[model samples]
Target: MAWNEPGNQGKDPWGNRGGKDQGPPDLDEVFRKFSSRFGGGGGNFNKMGVLLVLIGAIIVWGLSGLYKIEEAERGVVLRFGEFHEIVGPGLKWKPTFIDEVYPVNIQRVNRLNASGLMLTQDENVVTVQMEVQYRIEDPHKYLFRVTNPDQSLSEALDSALRYVIGHTTMDNILTVGRDKVRRDTWEELEGIIEPYDMGLRVVDVAFKEARPPEEVKPAFDDAIAAQEDEERFVQEATAYSRQVEPQARGRAERMLREANAYRERVVLEAEGEVARFTQLLPQYEAAPEVTRERLYLETMEQVFSNTSKVMVDNKDGGSMFYLPLDKIIQGGGSAPMVEQAPANRQTSTSSSGARTTSSDNSTGRSSVRQGRN
Candidate 1:
């Protein structure tokens, strides 16, 4: 028969001997039964369970301390909110609760931009843009030295840029002096951040743009164009001077040499004539008459050599004649003879020989007869 048939005394499946309310089982009895199944007394059961929990907690804590760092990163370790030590790349471990590790990318290059409208030395407002590229050098200083290193670097860039721009001119900033501005800003930025020890290194500073305000852009553009044209013109003029100067100097040198040569030739010829005349003077002083006669004959011979006409005289007082030999030869004809009247002819007898003179109408000169002995 079933237990609930109401024919026997009060009893239940959980071993409740008597109860007004047949509720769930008792907590203390359930614990005692579970301890007995585990083969431990109640006190030993509690202690063993606590030991297992503590061991698992320790394993988890030790496992949590193991961390990995990338090749480009450096690990910064902190102990109880104080900087401890820096760790390099690869697998690393640190105490979980006593130390903290922050991975910082030391090899990564970071960039910041700075731009603003600033007043120039010439009191002109110009907008300038600059870019700074940097990388972390010391991870410890980077994390601990400053609260916000990046923001500090940005502010430093701005300060440096403003200082440089203020000392420069508008024309230079907008045109040829942009590189100078970039370099100066970089130097100034380094100086500003040096004291702060921001743990930032400037890799490069690029001058992106520098221009006048929009309202004056066109005028500045025109001014910049004029400056470029002026530079080009100056360069071209310098090249031209370089090219033409040598030729001009060469021409001047050549003319000077030619003039010197001409002067020397003239002087040498004059000296030769003087020497000849000096030697002739002595012979003329030795015998005046003979020298005079010889000189007169030489002069006549030299004069007649250049003419084509000839004159002849007959010692028997016959008719005198002139022969035009040049015209006869050129015309391929016989010589043409011309007779002269005795009244028109002139004759003189020298001590050395008989002399006869004939007139040549073509050259209007008198010729002395040569064959008379």
Candidate 2:
């Protein structure tokens, strides 16, 4: 049967001993009873609750301010909307509502790329692509000094690149002068950023690509190919010259040395001849006739020593005798021995009708001697 039936009109499903309708128990009385059980008044309990709430809030605010910065990052702190100290990599804390922290990856390399069509110094148009690598050197300046450092850097890079490209030739942008263009752009970028103090350090600048526009690429390619061929030919010629020059120089040095040796030999021979003539002059002056005869005999003997034939004449009988000196020389005899003949035989040797006579023979024979040719 239902509890709110006619006989139990004031009674309900909840267990209440009275017939009057009742709501839930009062919260203030419930808290007051709980505090009485804890041996504290309601006012003291309220104060303790407030203290616990305050401590909990303080702990939460402190934990909320804690941050960890990685080894590659730096933290820039701002206090009351003003620049504060820069923090290195570590766990750090800041005031919750009064300070703000910005973590920047200072160690990480960041890259910005710029590419566009630019007019060159020679009034030619070309496409250039470049990349700038940089790092944050000072995080404080990076965060506060510029409104947008990355965008500023990109604009700076573009300006520098265009400036360099405008001052250079299209061929240089596209070919052998690429390194120069890259270096100039880098330097220009540094100069542009230095005055602003952007707190960015440019690690490197790479000129990634440069090319003529599509409408003129083929002609430019042909020109570049021709230039490459010319450079190759020049390098090959240089190498060949380097290789051959030493040999030519060596030949010239050898010829010079041989000429010097020949000159020295001729000079020494002339000096020797002069010395011999000087020694002979005194003897010739002491006894002119005897010396002249001796000299004549010596000269004749010297002349006949080179002949190949010998002729002997027997003066007593007017008979001529010929010795086959050429045959004798061919028979392995280089020299023939000449002796005084008998009294009846007179011997003479003539070299091409030249004669030398010897009269002091032991057998009273006159002898003329010659030599083989």
Candidate 3:
């Protein structure tokens, strides 16, 4: 029954404890007590923690300024958008809120083109197109000194192209002076950009296209055709020379070879004939009579085979000769022999009388033989 008292409810539900008032709490006790009412309070806090975090953030952003620049780039620092200074590659720093850095492309080449229908020095309109290659040499000047550098570059290119083409003839721009036009335009454009404080390094310039206006396209085509014709003519001439020179030389060589062969054959033939004739000449000298008789007989037989003419005279007759007129009249040789020689007044009347003989040889000489006894 006493365990049921309100004051004793908390105290002696298990019985036999008397109640007493608690003392004032210490600082640790007060905190502990408050924390018990609240949950996990003021456990992980230092007074400098907020300040430390702000300082850490500042340090992180500042250290983050340590950046590398590429080999082909240049770093420039701007303080509140004003040109502060230039920086180089690798681990560079600047104050975060005050200094800003930009890495400019220093070694990269950029391209620009100027193209349009423009007027030539001859007051003819033509389309001239050119390309320029450049790189940034001064980042500060490239960034700030010029207003819209790219647009300025374009305008400069346009101006240069127009001016150059204006001073150049149509034929020059189309053919013999194309390189000059490109080079002069580059030089002029570069000069314009430099004077205006745009820091650009001009690398090279080239002509992409240049031609007469569309209205004159037909004429231009005709000109090109004529030029091609000239080139073709030159090529054909060269080809002809190349072909004809060798052919002529070959012909000359063949002729020379033929002449040499003919010369050698003639020389050999002459030597053989000389040796044979030399052998025959000695044999004739050794036996003149026998050789002569044999030659006479052989020569006589050759003559009578083609002609028949007979003449007779008395053994003792003077200045007289009688041809067999009856046989001659009877067509003995099918035609009477006419006397082709002068008539003589004498004739031999002996055992052997003068007779004319004729011989034919299929050789070098024909002969008439006269034998008398």
Clashing pairs for model 2 are 304-371, 307-371, 307-372, 307-373, 308-373, 348-368, 349-368
Candidates' TM-scores?
0.64, 0.71, 0.51
Q: Write the per-residue lDDT of candidate 1 for residues 1-373, one digit (tens) a residue.
A: 5655565456766666754446768899988999999888899999999999999999999999999999999998999999888898999989898999999998898999999899999999998889999999999989889999999999999999999999999988887888888889989999999998877789999999888899998998899899999999999999999999999999999999999999999999999989987988899899889988888867766665543333333445543444444544565633332222244343322212223445578986656444433
By TM-score, the better pick of 1 and 3 is 1
User: Lowest-lDDT window of 10 residues in candidate 2?
Assistant: 350-359
Ranking by lDDT: 2, 1, 3
Report lDDT per candidate: 0.80, 0.81, 0.72
Q: Show how many residue pairs clash in every candidate, following the order shown.
A: 0, 7, 1
Residue 32 of model 2 has an lDDT of 83
Give the residue spans of candidate 2 off by over 4 A.
Answer: 1-46, 288-373
Top-TM-score candidate index = 2
Tens digits of per-residue lDDT for model 3, 132-241: 88889899899888778878898999998999999999888887789899888988887788778888888898799988878889999899788779879999999999
Best by lDDT: 2
